[model samples]
Target chain A: MTAEALTTILIAMLGGAIRVSTPFIFVALGETLTEKSGRINLGLEGNLVLGAMVAYAISFHTGSPWLGVLAAGFSGVFLGLMHGSICSLKKVNDIAVGIAMMSFGIGVAFFFGKPYIQPSAPRLESLPLGGWASNPALQQALEINPLFIVGILIAIVMWWALANTRVGLVVRMTGDSEPAARAMGINPIKVRILATAAGGFLAGIGGAFLSLSYPGSWNEGLSSGQGLMAVALVIFARWNPLRCILAALLFGAAGALGPALQSVGISQGYYFFNAAPYILTLFIMVAATGSNSARAAPGELSIAK
Target chain B: MAQAETSFATPPAYDTARIRASIEAVAIPLGALVASAIIFSVFLTLLGKSPLQFFELVWRGGFGSSFSLQNTLQRATPLILTGLAFAIPARIGLVMIGAEGALVIGGFAAAALAIPLVSAEAPVYLTMLLMVLIAMAAGGAWNAIAGWLKHSRGVNETISTLLLTYIAIAIMNFFVEGALRDPASQNKPSTMPIGKDYMVGNIPGTDVHWGLVFGLVLAVALQVLMSRTTFGFAARVTGGNPRAALAQGLPVGTLIVVCSAIAGACAGLAGYFEVAAIHGQANASLVAGYGFTGILVAFLARHNPLMIVPVAIMFGAIEASGGLIQRRMDMPDATALVLQGIIFVVLLASDSLYGRFAIFQPKISTERT
Candidate 1:
């Protein structure tokens, strides 16, 4: 291949990475928060789809993307509440309940979202980071969504708070040991529920981003299990909120490989490339799980050692 | 010899208290179903449809007529098998979400095997045997990946199995839509059909295939395997307390993998039936939510293989009636999914009732009595 073509492909790949990574960033952050609290919510995928549906419908009705985001977050909180409450009940397994909630949330989303599939919604716009560039490709590649930056900022804040703040310490203690948390006079259940709700909010926003931004459309097939993949991403990130952002971007890049390759007349093994993100996650999970220095996972987290 | 013979004899009578406890256990799921129906009724009202009419339609379309009953049974067959897939592994304390992957790969394997045998002079029974074996092997291997990860590397089975599912679906898509695509099926895009001669036969006096019988048989067999075997005892022990089982010198890792493989094999068999009896070939048509629905059935049945049979059929009837409800009531097809989801959550939450209910808790105030 010519250098010019190769460079174009590389640039397009970067652009695709950023575009796809936005949702991953939000979702991984959400999952990281939930995991840090020693409870894993696998139903984030449902939150994502429902959030997208709610966001799109609200945006279409109100002509405001921000409100749509809020609505999406609310829907996520609603799901998180259900998940947290059911899991808090004696004998109810959190992971299983998360799976159930996933199905339930998706059902509700599809049921309510039937009408919003065709309508256009006011979408969140990308910041013109490359406005001064003369090349169209360069400008397009540089146009980063604002949510990407917000996600990074949230990750940074979360990292700092987790290390220093009392609330963060409570969460850490609760996750490390329920007895320790109880000794400290903190309710582990409450902490987990709060963390789960916060995580759901972020995931819901991520879903909104998918519908109201890059993909810029609403459909049932819009989400291809990105929410579910985020759970693995959180673990791969070692439950670090900061690492979650980078991991999400990496996953986004992996997911975009097939489409980017397709755009440049390279269609061989597109399906395999499409499967890259899931394969990468499995590889990371195996590696992280076997590694001695994979970081000390939360004690109460079922996925954690 | 007299004492031994006396000990082997049947107990005097069925215990009324034990029977009542069993009935109470069932009440949780029943209550959840009723609650979900109420919640769904409100939803239907919001959508401008009558919940009564919806329920009536479900009854009418699912089991009112002989034709509908057959359709429900046909739908329930794979569900029963898949439910066993989930329920069996769940009994061993492994949440194997890779059944969808197993189903897809199994179906693909069935189709792949059939392609060669269709034109060959292979005997019909041999072809069927080859299909079942290949399908189960593919599925078993698929699930074994997650089991190995869990037992050897401490990776969580849930995430690993789920990720593998995506990879499995992608692999099948590549084969069916590209390499194995029949030139004639252009618009829908499917693998080559497995031909009428190689197809499974219908049960006597019914349009439904023999898979329903296969499902029922497997359920009963698994029930016996789980309740009456030493291996099942070890599996139960492992599930209840893995560390304790390890302390007892049980090969916990091997049991985990083997049990998971068996679970995957069950789902794979379901996939084989789908391809051989229903879809006629492996394609996107096999990607229906049978695997997911099976999870609910497993939960509703509390992961008992025998209970999975009835639970799966109930769900199957609900699913079969979904389209009819949509036509007659102007409700979305998602209505059925909503009900199923609600029932699943409620049933899971009902787990709390196990030790908390006084009916299940034996009375200790014998002195006062």
Candidate 2:
């Protein structure tokens, strides 16, 4: 390939990385928080689709995209409540609940969001970050969505709070040892419920990005399992909020490879390229799931075993 | 020993412990189903629709007539197979949800294989047999990858299976749109048809295809395999207590892999039937949600192979009625999904109530009392 061709692919990938990674960022971070609290929510995929639908429908009806984002988050919270409550019961497996919640969330979304499919919703606009570049293609590629920045900021804040705040300490303690958390007069169930809800709020925003920003529409096929992929991304990130951003970007780049190659007329193996992230995730999982990664995981995580 | 067992078992008048256990097993899931129906009724009522009509239509569309009953059974064929796909791995204590991917890959493999055999003018029976074998082999291999990873590398089976599912679908799409696309299949890219001679037909005097028969035989075989054989015992031991199984020198890894492969093969057969009996070709049309719904079926059956049949048929009935519900209730097709979701959640939640019910508990044996 020529240098120009290489540059084109890189730029396309970079653009794709940013566009695709925003959802990954929110979802990975949400999963990180939930996992740190010693629970894994695979149903975040459900939250994502529902969130996208709610975001689009709310934006269409209320005329404010941010309110749609808020509505999406609350919608996520509702599912999280269902998951947390069902899982908290004795003998109720959280993993199975995650699966059930995923189906329920998607079902609810599809049921309610059917009518909003055709109508256009007000969308969140990207910040003009690429104006400094002279070429229009480069300029268009550089237009960063505002949620990208907010996601980064949230990651940093989460990192700080996880270390410095009492709530964070409680979460960590509860995750590491339920008995110790109980002895300290903390209700681990309540902590888990709240963490799941808050984590869901983030995942909802991630869903908002899919429908309100890039690919900007409400549809059933809006998500091709991005929510489920985020759960994998969290494991790859080793449950750290800051690392989640980097992991998500890598995934985004992988996701972007197909469209990037397609844009540059290198469509020979587009489908194969689309499979890259999943293959990469499996390999990363194989490599990461040794003694060190296990130590990095919260001691009480049900998914760990 | 068989004769002795039959003779003694026939006259057991007070097997309360055995009787209660069986009753509890059946009663819990039934109660969950009823509860979900009630909740779904409330949902319908809130939307100003009559829940009674919705169910009435379900009965009418799914099982009211012989034709509808056949349709329900026809749909249940795949569900039965996919439910076993979920159930087998679940018996080995792995929650493998990659059956959908296996189905796609299996069907794709069968179609891809058919192209070569058809071009060579292979005999019809031979072509069908090879296609079935190839489909089962492909699916079993696909699911085995996840099982292998889980046992050998300590990667979580659930996540691994889920990832593999995406990869499987991608691979199929890659082939169908490229190497395997039949030029004749315009508007929808698909593999070359297996031709009418190779098409799977329904059972004699019934509209239900031979796939339902396949499902029944497999369910019975698996039920016996799980409850009667040494291999099944090892797998159950591994599921019940991995540490103990390892201590007893049972090959836990092999059991996991074997169970997963068997599960995959079941899903693969479903895919083959889907291609040969229903679609007559492979394409994006093969990407139905049967694999995911099978998870609910297996769970509702408590992962019992025998129980999967009734549960799968029930789900199939609900599924077959989707169009009817949509027309009668003026609801989206997702109404079925809503009911399913509610049923699944309630079923899992009802897990906690199993031991709590005093009546279902085994009667304490007391000579003095």
**TM per prediction:** 0.95, 0.97
lDDT of 2 by residue, A1-305 (tens): 78888888888888889999999999899888888888889899999999999999999999999999999989988988888888889998888899999999999999998999999999998998998898777888889999999999999999999989999999999888999999999999999988888888999999999999988999988998989987799888888899999998998899889888888788777889889999998998998877677778898888686
Q: What lDDT score is found at residue A210 in candidate 2? A: 90
Instruction: Give me candidate 2's TM-score against the actual structure.
Output: 0.97
Clashing pairs for predicted structure model 1, backbone only: none
Per-model fnat list = 0.83, 0.85
> Lowest summed lDDT over 10 consecutive residues: which window, candidate 1 chain B?
B360-369
Once fitted onto the true fold, the runs of candidate 1 whose alpha carbons sit more than 4 angstroms away are A290-294, B1-21, B46-48, B365-369
Chain A of candidate 2 compared with the true chain A, TM-score: 0.98
**Which run of 10 residues does model 2 chain B get worst, by summed lDDT?**
B360-369
Model 2 accuracy (lDDT, Cα): 0.91
- Tens digit per residue, CA lDDT, model 1, A1-305: 87777777777878888899888888888888888889889899999999999999999999999899899999999998889888999988888898899999899999888988877888998998989988798899889988888888999999999999998899888888999999989989999889999999999999999889978788878998889888888877888888887888788778778877777788777788879988888887888765642556888877765
DockQ for candidate 2: 0.88
